[model samples]
Each structure stands twice: as structure tokens, then as C-alpha cells.
Target: MLPAQICARNERAKAHSSRYNSKRMKVGTGRLRPHRSISAGHNRDDKRMKIGNKSGAVAFAVMFAILREFVMKFVSILLALPLTMAISACATTSTDASAPAAASMAGAKLMAGDGSARGTASVTEAADGLHVLVKAQGLTPGIHAVHVHMTGTCTTPDFASAGGHWNPTGRKHGMNNPAGMHMGDMPNMTVGPDGSGAIEYVIAGGTISGEATPLLDADGAAVVIHAQADDNMSDPAGNAGGRIACGVLAAG
Candidate 1:
């Protein structure tokens, strides 16, 4: 062969050999593991980060929901505790039939014209009218007239400031008169020799308040015991002499 032809053939063989080696290397590396680009590696990292973030969010949401549920239950328990205690206390408390019912009521402390203690009185509201109770002390042993008076004032001495009888109906005083009785008219109270007495009465169709003519109006009302007995047929006040004891009504 010529020298130039031999050299060209040898170069061609070297080039083919180089290409074959490169292809073999590629196939060998592919069998071992797939080759990755820089961008593909970055995409895998991004996907891992996204999964981590989603897992964290789900865990946080579950924790928060659990915390909220616990808080709600705790609050409900706290709110019910007082009511439970109150109900238990009420259940354990003793009740008496002689005790006054839980109703609208009022009370008053009586004082004589000389400012001495004269006992106490209470008025309880009922479906009918007012249930009046009076306990008296420091009085003479005799019969006396007890009546509801106009004003609450008890200006000492004769106690005339406790105006006239609480005659809201404007009828004649005594219970037996032809003109009939006043709303203030009540039965006579008997004072014992020990100077103490108690009387209970009910004023029909009367009210403590919230009416045009309630007993406890702006001017208020009072209980008065007179020196003399009511004859049951007298006008204005049944000739009940002077007011010996007076008490101002107060609401309870």
C-alpha cells in the first residue's frame, strides 16, 4: 500500500474505536443508575420540600383542632360547675311548712310616740290582696283599733302626721255602717295584761304597689293603733281616739 492511504485508514479506525468506547461507557452507566440533570435534581428537591410542608400543615391543623375541642369542653365544664353546686345546695336545704312562702313581701318596725320600741309588722302579697301581720308591745291592756293609715310619717307625740285612715274607697269607716266600710277598716286588736299583742288580717283587693291606689304609693302607707275601740258603726275612723303606735311600711 502507499504511505498516505495507510495513514488515512489508520485514522479512520482510531475514530471508530473512540466512538465505540463512548457508546459502551454510556450504556454501562445507564445500567448501573439513570443519569440526572441539574434541573431534574432541583425538581426532586422541590417535590420533597412540598411534601414536607403539606405534612407539617396537616399535623398543625389536627393539633389546633384538638386544642379547640379541649378548650370548648373545659369551658363547658367550668360553666356547669356553679349551676351544679347551686342545685345541690338547694336540694340539701331544709324546708318548713310553717315558714313563709317565697312571695313578694314588706316589713316595718313600729315605734311609739315616745320613740320606744313597739314591735314589728309584715305584709305579704297574695292573690286576693295583702296579708297583714302585726306584733305589738308596750301598750295598755285593752281593746284598740288597728287600721291602715294614709302617710308613712310618724312625727312623734300624737303621731297625727300619719294622716287619716287609708280610706282608698272613700266609704264610711266602720264595718257595720249603712254606708259600709273603708279599705283601712280592720277588726279591733285586744292587748293583753302583759302589754303585748299579735293580729293577722287581710285587706281584700288591695295592693302593695303598682296600682292607682296601692298601699305603698308615692306617699307610702302606715299601720296605726288607736287608743280606743272601733264601735263597728262610726264614720271616718270609728271614733278611734289617738294614734298610740305608728309604723312606716317598707318594701322587702
Candidate 2:
């Protein structure tokens, strides 16, 4: 009787123990499956975040490259502007260096009294006094008295507006006068057969540059040609006839 009872109790105990272990294992497996699913979801989210960061980095690099290119182009343009301006200024300066100077020349263009002649005159300050060179054409081909008048005025017809001879010292008119000799008296000029003549006179007594006998004073002076020859000793124009050709002396 004891052996039979002990065997039945052991079988019952073994069955209960097996059922409890089965239930505990099922619950543990269910919890482990849910944990694995949550881990996988987290890994997928991390991958997506890494991809977004990489895209953002690429966009920033592209913008930086564009900005660098634009800045480089602007800097190049700024550096070339001054060189271009300097070259243009140098070209302008070269053109202004070829003109003639104006301080070494004094001249005048002669107009005829009766519109029958034209001439030119040039005066230069020399070491002695002043040198005058005069050239005339289309005249009457005869002896004519040429004198430097006091006034520069030369009107038409009679040419009486040229005034008297250039007598700054208030002496007599002729070169051989008894009381005095006028500074404006000059030798007679003989025209050629072709109605053209040239005279070059170097003034030794008077001056065309100084203030004493200045040819280019405030009132100025003129070269007047008479119709007749001078007697050289007569007073007041040496008996020369009417005025023929006159030219105002201009200063340079």
C-alpha cells in the first residue's frame, strides 16, 4: 500500500513543475521580442538623422563656393581700375608737350594804306639794341620813307591816324637836324622793279624792348611807309609825302 501512494504523489509533483516553467518561458520570450522591435526602430531613426546632416553639409559647401567665386571676381575688377586710369593720363600728357612756346617772338602783319600792298615785320631784342626785319610786296617800285610812328593807329585812305614819328625823347624829326635828331628817323627804302622789297635794320641808338623807347608800350607803335623819299635833314617827317602802308607792332 505505501509504494503505490508514493509513486502517484511523485508523478503529480513533476507535472506541476513542468507547467510553471512553460508559462514563465512564454512571458520572457514575449518581452524579448518587443525590446528587439524598439531597438530596430531607434536604429532606423538614427540613420535618417545622419543622412539629413550630410545633406545640410553639402548645401553649405555649395553656398560657400559660390560666394568665394563672386568675391574673387569683384576683387579683380577693383585692382585693374587704377592701372587703366594711369595709362589714360599718360597718353594725355604726351600730347601737350609738342606745342611752341610764346615768350621768344614779337611780330606784326602790315596792311597797305590804299589797299595796294601787304607786308610782315618782326622785331627781336639783340645784344646791341633791337633788330627789325621787314618784308613788303605789291608797291609802286620807287624810293619810300619808312618810319616807326608813335601811335599804332592806322586808318584807311590817308593813314593820318598813325600820328607822328616815335619821338619819345621829344627831339627834332630828321636825322640831320641842327637842334637834335629824332630817334624815329630811319634811312630811305628803295623798292625793286618787281614792287617787292625787304629791309633789315639794327637799331643802335633807340630800343624796342626798354621803357625809354619801347615799341610795345601801352599806346604801342607802328611801321609806316611814306609815298616819297626822306631828305634826311628836314624836320617833321623829312618832307615825305602821304602815308602809304602801315603795320601795327604786336607783342607776343
Candidate 3:
């Protein structure tokens, strides 16, 4: 080979090396290396595209965070709804538990000679007078006399501790007697075959308290049911037999 031919071959080899370096990635620091255009078509739009992608990512993150917060708050509210309703229900029940009844009255439980529960009685004050209600049980199916006695004390056994018919005004017993009806005088009670009896009567011009002739005095009052019926014209006793059931009236 000649010297000129060898120089031409070396020149071709150097040109091929330069072309290979141009196609490879550049690793030199920007400040240390001279500025050069990687491609003639490159523009400022590339920087804007990168910035737009970052902005889109930030916006998506912000929206996701807001949605997460909204979902958490909604779930919390749903969880608390039942607790709030339960608290309201408890408050309402407490209010109702404090209230019982709304009537001023008196009551008594009648007991027989053997101390067994026989009946119940109640006295309520109204505009007319003292309203009396008597419910008798465990009694024979027949007519019986029920009267308000003078004393509230109802001794066991005979129940003679309860005095005669209550007469605030001096008068004889029996509604049929002229100028004779006592304050304790009332109609006879007829028991049913089921051993139950009920009677309701309002004593005229009578009162439980705050009056001259109140049914309940310092010693209170007693309700007595006799075994036999009243003759309706009998004086003082009305021929009513032994006291079967007796109860002491108490204010409620």
C-alpha cells in the first residue's frame, strides 16, 4: 500500500467515529459544556408540556384529597345518626318516667275477716261532691250493704272497730227514711255470680276536706260492707248484719 492510500483510510475511520459519538446520549454537565442544539426543530413548547403534566398531576392529587375528605365526613355523619336518635329517645323516656298520674283522689283496699284481699275503693272530689267508687270481690251473689263508717280504723276479725254509719249531720241511716238519710247512707250493692261487685255514688253536699262535714276527718273514714242487705227504712243500724269487708280511706 502507498502512504497516500493509508492517510485516506485513516481519514474515513475518524469521520465514522465522530458520527457514532453524535448519535449517543450526552453526559457532560451543562455549565462545563458549550451550548449546542440537539435538534433544529426543538422549541420552548417542550418545557410547557412538562409543566402542564406536573400541573395536571397536582390538580388530580388535590381533587382526590378533597373527595377523600368528603367521603370521610359523610361516613362520620351516617355513623352518628343512630346515636343521636337513641339519645333523643332516652330523653323522652326519662321525661315520661317522671310523670305518673294527674288526679287528686283517695283509695283503699278492702280486706275480709281472714285478712284476704276482698275489694278496692276510691274517693274522688269533684265539683258536685265526693265521688265514691267501690269494687267488691270474693262475695256471694246477693244484695249487700255498703256504708261509710265513722272511724277509719278497721280492726281485724269482727271489724267492730269501725263505728256506725258516718253521720256528719245528726240523722238516722237508710235513704228511704224521711229526715233520716245519714251522710254514709248509700244504695245497696248487688254482687254478680262471678263474685265481683261495683258501686259508684256521689255524696251530695259532701267533701273530703276543707269543709264542715268532710268524709275524711282527723281519724279518717272507713268503708264497711255488711253481709246482709239494708231494709231501707231502719234507723241507726238499718238491720244490716255483721261487717264482712272493711277498708280505711286514705288520701292519695
Model 2's alpha-carbon lDDT is 0.80
* lDDT accuracy of residue 139 in candidate 3: 96
- Screening candidate 2 with a backbone cut-off below 3 angstroms (N, C-alpha, C), the clashing residue pairs are none
Q: What is the per-residue lDDT of model 3 for residues 114-159, given as tens digits with 9 covering 90 to 100?
A: 9999999999989888899999999989999999998999899889
- List candidate 1 segments past 4 Å from native: 1-103
Q: How many collisions per candidate? A: 0, 0, 0
Query: What's the best-to-worst order under TM-score?
Result: 1, 3, 2
TM, every model: 0.59, 0.56, 0.59
Tell me the TM-score of model 1: 0.59
True-structure lDDT of candidate 1: 0.87
Point to the candidate with the largest TM-score: 1
Name the candidate, 1 or 2, with the larger TM-score value. Answer: 1
lDDT for model 3, on a 0 to 1 scale?
A: 0.88
